[model samples]
Structure formats: C-alpha cells, structure tokens
Target chain A: MSPAQHEPDEDPGAPASSHAVSAPGAPSAARPKVPRRVAWRRLSTISRARLSRGTLLAALLTLVLGLALVAQVRSTQTADLENLRETDLIALLDDVTDRADRLEDEVRSLEQDRSRLESGGGDAAAAQAAQSRLESYQILAGTVPVSGPGVSVRVSDPEGEVTTTMMIDLVQELRDAGAEAIQIGPARVVATTWIGVDEGRLTVDGQPVAAPYSVVAIGDGHTLAGALAIPGGFNDSVRRVGGEVQVTEGEELVIDAVHEPPTLEHARPVPPSEGR
Target chain B: MIPVLGLVVGVVLGLMLQPEVPGWLEPYLPIAVIAALDAVFGGVRASLEGIFNDRVFVISILSNVLVAGLIVFLGNQLGVGAQLSTGVVVVLGLRIFSNVAAIRRHLLGA
Candidate 1:
C-alpha cells in the first residue's frame, strides 16, 4: 500500500484497478463519500498509478466506443435512411402512393376534358383540351382585344377625391357580376393586373391614369350595370368621394387595350402528343 | 480520464480514416454501435462501483453486438428486417438509458 494513496480521501474513490485494493470486496465496503476528484486522479494517473487488466480492456473498449460512436453519429445524422423503422418506411411509402393516386385521378379528369376538346386536333389533347381554350387564353394572356355585351363606367373626379380603394371596388364588383374581360384606363385587367396608388395617383399595373377613370367590362351588360348601381354599392361609394358615376349599358363594348405576351426564359409549351 | 483520452484518440482516428462501411455492414454497424454503448455504460458503472471485470466487459460487448446483428440479419431473411431492427434498437436503447441513469447517480451520488 502506498502511503500517499492511503490519505483516506484519495483512496476511497481511487479503486479503478484491482491492485489499488488489498481485497476485492474491501474497497466497496469502505467510505463512499469521497469526491469524483479522487476517481479522476485515479484514472488520470493510470500510466503512473496502475495498469490492471480491467482498466486496460476498458480503455481499449472506450477507444472502440469512440470509433463506433462517431461512425454511428454520422450515419444517423446524414441523409441516410437506415435508421427508420420498417413501419415508418412503409407509412412513408403508403403516403407517397396515396399522393400518386390522387395525381393520377386529376390527370384522368384533365385527360377527359382534353378528349372532349380534341375530338380530332391531329395531336394529343394535353396542350389543348377545354372548350373555348383559345378564347380563354387570349382573354387571360391579354394578347388580343375583346368585345361583347358589357357595361362602361366613367367616374369624373374634378376634386381628384377618388381613391385607389374605390377603383379596386369598382373592378371587383364588375368581376363579381361576371365581367369576362375588363379594361381600366388603357390597361387590360388580366390575372396579373394590380390596382394601387403611386404618388397620390391611381395606378393600374404601375401605370398612372388620371380621372375621369373610364372602365369597360365585356360581359352581360344588364347584370354589370345593375350590380354597379345596387343601392349603397359601387355607385354610392364613388358619389361618396364627390365623383360622378356614369354607367352606360351597351349591347357591345369594345376593349382595344392589349398586353404584350410575357417572354418566356424558362417555361415553354409542351408539344402535343400524336394519336392521344 | 485516461480511458476517455483513449476514446478521443479513437474518434480522431475514425474521423481521419472515414472509411466507408461495406454494404453488408451498413445495416449492422448502427446496431452494433448502440449495443456497444450499453456495454460501455455498464462498464463505467462497474468501474465506479469497484466491480469492473475485464472478462465480463469484453464478453458482454461482443455478445451484444453479435446478437443485435444476428437479429437484424434473421429479420431480413424472414422479410421482417425492418421490424426486427426496430426491436433490437428498442431493447438496447432501454438498457442504455437505465445504465446511463445508474452511472449518473453513481458519479453524482444523487
């Protein structure tokens, strides 16, 4: 027994090796109140203190643990899917299958629409399916001027009291009343159209148009005019701003403004399939 | 602490090598690592209790890893590889948590 290790405090927890004790059962029965510092000292001084078989094997095993630990950590944390349970993987596969089935159903319906339109297009119906697709595209793309039975709205605001809200409300009401094609102050109101205020001027798609704002919407003229003149509706909101609301129902309203088709750097029409 | 240093050296060696695990070893590697962890926790607890036995530690570590890998391999043969792998991990994970808890109390005297 070394006199230094018998100082009671250091010896109590320094039994990392069997050689540190006279009897194997003696150390466990001794004082168990020592700090972890003694154990730390016992382990830290392993090369100088003692090299028992248990300590040696423990060291070797710890080294293996380290290698395995890092390897396992990297594997689990990486994009590898090895850690997932079979049930979890099955569930994921099932979810994907469900999504694919839903997409197939949607494709089938779209294919049905195409077949109806493409009774005989000399090409597959993918790119051309729905009835009135050409007219719809022209109207939505704003590539061609449109005309039909519709209503014309002219609001003259001498005081310039008309705000952007009134302008948007006017267009929204026309849309709700089934206006198929709408033109507000030389700008065709397509899907990408925006109504906002810039420098205290009402802007349609970033282009400012001064009052009196003339809006022509091609749709059912009777329905558009009636929707605008509804009590306390768009007609009242314009008059509330001290602007004159003049709505005229025409059998045919012409909207000559055409928007330049957007140039495509990425998207291109997929070519039609033969003998769909 | 010196044993911990051994582990650190082992970690550095592993990182430097970064050897790709063989395809057959891929499934078993993670299982073996976790099983080895259980053995490590038991060893640390035994060391603190002055009951660490090198022979027992070595046997337990080897058996744990082998048995875990075997279970996964058998499951794959039976068309339930994923399920059996889950079973091994759950059992080993439970054992590891309990051993770690013991080690914590032993060191902290809590």
Candidate 2:
C-alpha cells in the first residue's frame, strides 16, 4: 500500500517478465509457464507485506511443536506399561494371580498349625513355652490375626498428588505412635514390606492399592489418632497435597491379613553367643 | 536466515527443558509435528522460488497442525486412530519429500 514498498515490488517483476518473454521458444515451457508466472507474482507481493510478524508467529509455533515432540518422546520412553502388548498384559495378570494362589495356600497351612498348637495336649510349662513362641512368630511373620482398640485412617488422593514417599511417611508415623500391627487393604505391613508406585497406583509388596486407602492400625486409638492429627503430620501433609485423610477411633480394630515372608537367599542366622 | 535461527533455538529449548506433555495430548503430538514439518518445507520451497508469502505460510502452518490433530482425534473416537494416523503421515511425508526436492532443484540447480 505504501509508495516505498511498491518500488521494490516492481523492481523484482522486471527480470521475471523479461525471463517469461525469452522462455516462450522452449517446447516444454508452454504447459507450466502461465500458472508458474502467476504464482511467482502473487508470492512476491504477499511476502513483501508484514514480514516480521509472520516470521515470528511461525517461529513461536515451531518452538511449541518442537517442545511437544521432545516431551512426548521422553514420556513414552519412561512409561513402560503403556507399551505392553495384549499378550504381555495377559502374562502379567497371570503371574499376579499365580502369586496370589501360592500366598493363599501358605495362609491355609499356617492357620491349621495355629489351631493344632492351641488344642494339642501338653504340660503347663511346655504349653506356655509353645504359646509364647507362637505369639512371637505370629507377630514377626504377620500371620496370626490381631484385634484390639486402635484407629482407622482412610486416605484419598483424588488428584494423584500423593507420592510413594508420603505413604511411607504415613506408615512410619503410625509405627511411631506405638502401632503393633497395621493393614493397608489386603496387604499387611511387616518389617520388610516395601511401598512403591506401580502403573500410577500405590503398591505394597507389588500388589496395587487403589485410592481411598484404608489403613487399620492396632494400637491405642487416641494415641494413633493424635499422631496423625498433630500439626505438620501425615494428615496435614496429605491435605497440603490436594488429598484427604480421615481418622476415627474404634473400640475393636481387626487386621487379619498376612504378609509373605521373604525367602532368604544369603546369610544364615548366627548362633547366640554362649557367654551371654 | 531468521527462520533457521528460530528452528535452532527451538530445538535447543526442546532438548534442554524436556517438559512433560500431558497424557491426553500424547496421541496427537507426533502428527501435529509432522504437519508443521510439511509447512516448513513448503515455506522453504516457496522462498526458493521467489514466491514465499508470509501470511500464507503462517496460515498453512496453523491449519495444518489443527487439521492433522483433529483427524487423529476423530480416528481415535472411531476406533481407527492408528490407521488414520498412518494415512496422515504418508500424505504429509510425500508433501515434505516433494517440497525438499523443489528446494534442492532451486538451490543446487540439479
């Protein structure tokens, strides 16, 4: 539109028109010549106007596209489960079920042994020794069921902001409150229980535990509740991270779930020192 | 020259930041990138031919990205996302190849 811009526009057209005139003699030029000239003229006219804004817009968009591309590649690379084939998913499910069946069989045998120990005839001293041993084994192995006054904590992470670290802290807080036994859903927390994230869900011993996580702790109900209710405690932490936690005292809280004892691959138990 | 500098900066920022794309947008990203690539190649070809229109280049880039993403999204809703994505890629790939060929012919005179 400006007189200054029109001067350069006409300058480029002079050579193009001269070339068009000289190219008419060629046999192959006739078919494509007319359209090519029109396109050439139109492009020069448009490129001359508002050059800076257009180039900047294109650059910004390309930057965004580049960022999205790199981000997507990195995300897909890190997310292993998303790449699983149908057969792989099925195999994974089968493996989990098999493990569950084996654990169930172990639980059945442990229960039978517990019943026999209680009913078998024995002298009072021998019976008392056996009872003590059973209690210790039950506590360590997380096999025997426990029922006592305690607190139940229900945690819900609607936004998935709660990490595995937060869950571990919650469990630790319960233990610090003198919790003797704890059950998270069907999985019992033992000395060796591992908490981790699997497929975007919290997992205890490789078993996925969904949100609205129920935590039952066998301890003094008031003490357990107070620990979680303390300032900057587990409940406060969950709330800070866009999650919810509810704690309630109960007269009788039962945790019957058992944990699978880790099979030892190394290091046998050393005999107690004789001098002691 | 400016566009090339922009591209280099874009690539560097992409590499250095490594931001995480949300889960819902993952499926559409690669297709949109391919479409943008086609537009860039076409722009290069136009510039070589002395017919590069800035407005046309920007409009084409925007529309190409949106349309490509839309096609894939519709395909996903219809349960044919993978097939349609292949179709979009093949078409855009051909466009890119032809545009590159034009640029090569203009610059190298081959």
Candidate 3:
C-alpha cells in the first residue's frame, strides 16, 4: 500500500491541538457536562432496572421474614427459660402436697400404734413392725435423719437443645444404679415420684434445672459411677451429645428434711402373727 | 407482600379465635390448614413438572404434622405447651423463608 494511502487520514494538528486544550480545560469544562444529579439518576435507573420488582419484593420480604424468624427463635428461647422456672415451682408444689398427705397418714398410724402399745395386746409385735416401716419411710422422706457414706450425683440437661425425656432416662438409670437418695431439679427421690417435663422443660423435685442438668444422688460413689458409665448409662448417652455427668464422694449429703407420709388410722389392725 | 399480608392476617385471626373455639379442635385446625395449603400448591406445581415423588411429599407431610403434634403434646405433658408452641413457630418461620425463596425463583427466574 502507498504511504499516502496509509497515513493521509491523520490531521497532524488534530492530536496536539486537542491534547493541549483538552488536557488543562477538559476536566474543568467536563465537570458540569454531566451533572452529578444526572449521573446519579442514570446509575439509579440502571440499578433499579437490573434489580427486578419481583426480586426486590422477594428480597424485602425475605428480610422481614428473617427478622421475624430471629424474633421467634429468641422468644422461644425466652419462653423455654421461663418454663424452666415454672417447672421447678410446680414440682415443689407437688412435693409439698405429697408431704401433707403423707403426714396425715403417719399421724393416724402413730395413734393406732399408741393404742395397741397401751392395750398390751397380742398385736404389740405387729405394731412395732409397722412403726419400723414408718421410720424407714420417714428417713426416705428426709423427715428423719439417716446418715451413711454415699455419693451424690448431679444430672442436668444442657441450657440449649436438651430434651426432658433424656433427663428422665438419666434419672431412671441413676436410680437403677442403686442411688439411695436422688434429687432431680427440685423433686426429691421417692417411690411414687417420676421425672416430669413441664413446658418443654424438665424439673426434678421442685427446682428448675438450669442447663447442664444437675442430678444429685447419695449412694456408693464407686457403684453409682460404674452404673452411670455402663453401656446404657446416662454418661454414655450424655457424652454422645456433648453433655456432662459428674460424680462426687462425700462424708455427708444431707437431704434437707422432707415431710412425713400419711397413714389411714382407719386401717384395721391385723393380728401379730398375721402381720409377721 | 400479598402472601405475607395473608399470612399475618390469618395468623392473627386464628390467634384471636383460638380461645373462643371448643377446646378439642381449636388448636389443630389452623396449623393443619396452612400446612395443607402449602402442600397442595407445592404438590400441584411439582407434579406438573414430574418432580412430585410420593416419598418426598409423604415424608415432608409426616414430619410437618409430627412436629406440630409433638409441640402441642409435649407442651401439654410438660405444662409448658405454650412454650413448645413457640419452638414450632420458629420452625414455621424457617418454612416461610424457603417458601418465599421458591416463589421468587419461580416468578423471577433468578
């Protein structure tokens, strides 16, 4: 190709002239060329168009929904905490009710025993046996002081994500392990007692188990520990889901005194031989 | 917006009416209705697309019902039935997210 044909299109002065003028004045002159408002408007329109109405609505809805979800979760947690509190109180009330009924029964039984003792009747031996049984029950209730070297076990459900059933299973296992005396959240260990869940929350006795369920029992520490660590023990299951089971040996684990059980004074007194 | 509004209204109405209704049927019907509607709409669309497997639908339906049932049952058993219901509500809140996401994807192709 001819040099003229290849290069003839260039305006030799065009580059220099535009460069000199545009370099110094270009920025200042162009400053107002596209106003800030116009640029912003263009950008806003582009973004608005790119983000469709449906998507925006969906996003906004999702945001509101997410907030609601968070609120719901928080409220749930709070309610669970409150329920935990109430469960303890209910357990306490139940214990008290049971105690009152038991005391009435015991007083009546004692009156019968007193009459039999005074009568110097053949049922005297039988009356003594009844009295012994009553004593044991009273000890079990913590109304009478019974002391021995035993371990205390505490089993508590964790603060978050622990179920009531799991706590009950643990308590049962402990009792099976020969825990002489056990205290769950607030419920004292007793023959008629069963671990109960209240409001998605579990309580022992009459106390709320704040997370990390505290299962306190009085028994042989070694035996209790072994029982809890067995294959089907509370320890194994608790460990499966990152829970804690602690055992401590002590010289004394004084269960605060509980009330006496009731007896039916109206129950017929059997003959000594028959009672034996 | 419309769906959210509908949900809010429905929830409020159900909550207000709950106390006035008979004890036995009052608690279950509202939740069951919502779940049913969700399943019906979801199933119709998925089935038309040949993606509605019986197993998936059954499992989802059973799980949803079980959760609702357990919340009520546990709450009653524990004497904290209301609190457990709160947990159920949290799960429902999550379902709302998934539902909204599905709707958005279907309508906007995004």
Candidate 4:
C-alpha cells in the first residue's frame, strides 16, 4: 500500500489505531496538542472496518485454540500415569495387592459370621449350647466337682492288698458304664489322672491312700453298680486280691474332688475361613 | 485493535465453554495447538511488517492445525508417532521463535 501516511518515527503501539500522530506517550508530550476530531476520523476509516471484520473471524478460531490448550493441560495433569520407574510401578502394584488381601480377609470373616448367625437359631439357643459345652468340659476335665445319680464302691482292704492295678481297673469299669465323673479315695479321677505305687505306697496321682477306699462315680447308678458286679470284673478282681468290695447304687452320689485342667502348649484352633 | 480484541474474546469464550475433546482428537490436540500458535505469531509478525493479509492469516492458521494433526495421525498408523511428533514440534517451535523475534524487533525497534 505505498506507506502513504509515513511519519519520521511512529510509535509501536500507534500502528493498531492507524494514527501515529495520536500517540499518547512520547509524541503527545513533544507536540503538546493534536486535533481530536481528525484522530477520530482516521479511526473510523473503511479499510480499518474491513480489517476489524476479518480480525473478529480470526479471534473466533482462537476460541477453539484456547479450549484445546486447557484440555491438554488438564489431561496431562490427571492422567498419563504410564511414565514411571519400575520400582514405582511395583510399589503401586503392591499397594493394590495389599488392599485386595485385606478386602478378601474381611469378606471371609463376614461370610463365616453370617453363616454362624443364621444357623445358631437365635441368641437363646446359642447361649444354651455354649452352657452345655462348658458343663461337659468341666465334668470331663475334673475342673469342677460334679454330683449326679450314680453308684458308690467301698473296698475294705484289711490286708492292705488293693494295688494300683486294681484301682485303675475299677476306674476303667466306671468309665465304660458311661460315668461322667469319678473320685477315688481323696483324689479326683480324670482323663490325665495316674494310679501308681510310689515308694511301696498305693498312691492315686502321687497321693498315698489307706485301706477302706471309697470310689464315687457320677452316672446311671444301676449301670455303674452292674458294671462293678459283672463276672470277673472290678468286684472279682478285688476279691481275688483278698480285698472285700461293696457296691451300692445311689440317686445323689457326689464326687466332690476337683483337679486342675492342664494348659495347652502347642495346639491352636484352625482358622474358620481358610479356603476363602 | 480489533484483531487483538477478537483474540481476547476467543480466549474468554474457550474458558467459558471448556468443552471436552473426543477420544480420537486427543492425540493430535497438542500438535494442533502448537501449529496454531505458530500461525498466530506469524500473523502478528506480518502485521508488524505491514504485510498482514486477512485471508492469508486465516488460511495459514487453519491449514497449519489441520496439516499438523494429519501428519501425527499418519505417523501413528505407520508406527512413528513419537518421532514424527518430535520432528513437527521442532519445526513449528523454530518458526514460532523466528516470528516472535521479528515481532519483538518491530515493537522495540531494536
């Protein structure tokens, strides 16, 4: 376009307005004054109006440009987790595995608890079952003194000839008759009780016993008495050893002797939710 | 004055819209943006040089973005996306730098 409106030194900022003379910075101070009407006329020119229309269209395209830019920035920040060292990746994998393990454990425990709760028939039934089991353990373990309908045996050994073997046979005979508890002399008889002779003394679990030994068994009284009187049984064995055996059936025989239950050293309960 | 005003309005509009780019378009967006930036700088430099043409400026920006995106897409199909993207970025970056330098020179008269 011929550079028709040439000036000696046009201000850079004055180009967009297309009126270098109207520059407000250095030129305004140097010249002191310029016609505001002429400046306005130059601004309202037809060529400038045409350029303005084209600029509007160009700026519309920039809208897409701006949007794309922001989206790219956002995507970069939030995703693209692929870039990492191997150790970091492994650590992330480990974290995920640990979380999965914890969730699996929780799932297993919840499933077991749900099944137990459903089958237990309710709070009352569960409590009753627990109480029954506790009583059984107490009696079988000889941790508590037990009284029930059973039979009592009196051995009158005037010759002091009732050996440990005879006493053991009597206890075995009582157990076979469904006897839940037994007391021989001053000692309580349990699964772990030992009848042995120590220093030539008839000892029941390390305690010496004298003549006239009384054995109390808590079970069906007739059943225990019949077992003691069976042919070639506890009565025959004691009689053969020159000891007189007297068996008496009673409804309320008491085995007041109690023993300490041994503590477990190595055994443990298995986990209920093993497969899960 | 109007051109710069239009650009500012476009930026404001883009911010307000914040539209989501589709999956297919994601890979090429960065390339396209860089190409558009190159065109914008060229246009500004040309305007400072008093050789600014409305049709040329518009066509340059539109064609630059499209051609850059197309190149990246073709490179992806040929399994050279990474290399091609780097090459395209380097060329566009050089052009943008030269244009900006020219713009700076024009503005400062240095």
Interface RMSD list for the candidates: 8.1, 9.2, 21.9, 8.7
- The worst-scoring run of ten residues by lDDT in candidate 3 chain A lies at A12-21
lDDT of 3 by residue, A173-209 (tens): 7677777776654456676565555666665554455
Segments in model 2 whose C-alpha atoms lie over 4 Å from true places: A1-51, A83-276
* Top model number, DockQ: 4
| Fnat of each candidate | 0.36, 0.29, 0.00, 0.26
Clashes of 2: 0
- Lowest-lDDT window of 10 residues in candidate 2 chain B? B101-110
Tens digits of per-residue lDDT for model 4, A134-214:
999888889888887988889998887788888888888899999989998889998778988877778888888777988
Residue-level lDDT of model 2, residues A48-87, one tens digit each, is 5344886777667777766766776777788787645445
CA lDDT, candidate 4, residue A79 = 58
Candidate 1: where are CA atoms >4 Å away? Answer: A1-61, A101-276, B1-3, B14-23, B75-94, B97-108
**B1-110 per-residue lDDT for model 1 (tens digits):** 44556678879978987655666788788888888777776666555655555667776777778888899899889989877888778766655665555455555644
What range of 10 consecutive residues in model 3 chain B has the weakest lDDT sum? B43-52
**CAPRI-style class, candidate 2:** incorrect
Q: Write the per-residue lDDT of candidate 2 for residues B17-50, one digit (tens) a residue.
A: 8787777777788898888888777776666555
* Model 2: per-residue Cα lDDT at residue A131: 96
DockQ of 1: 0.16
TM-score of chain B of each: 0.92, 0.96, 0.57, 0.92
Q: Model 4: what TM-score?
A: 0.54
* Clashes within 3 Å, all models in order: 0, 0, 33, 0
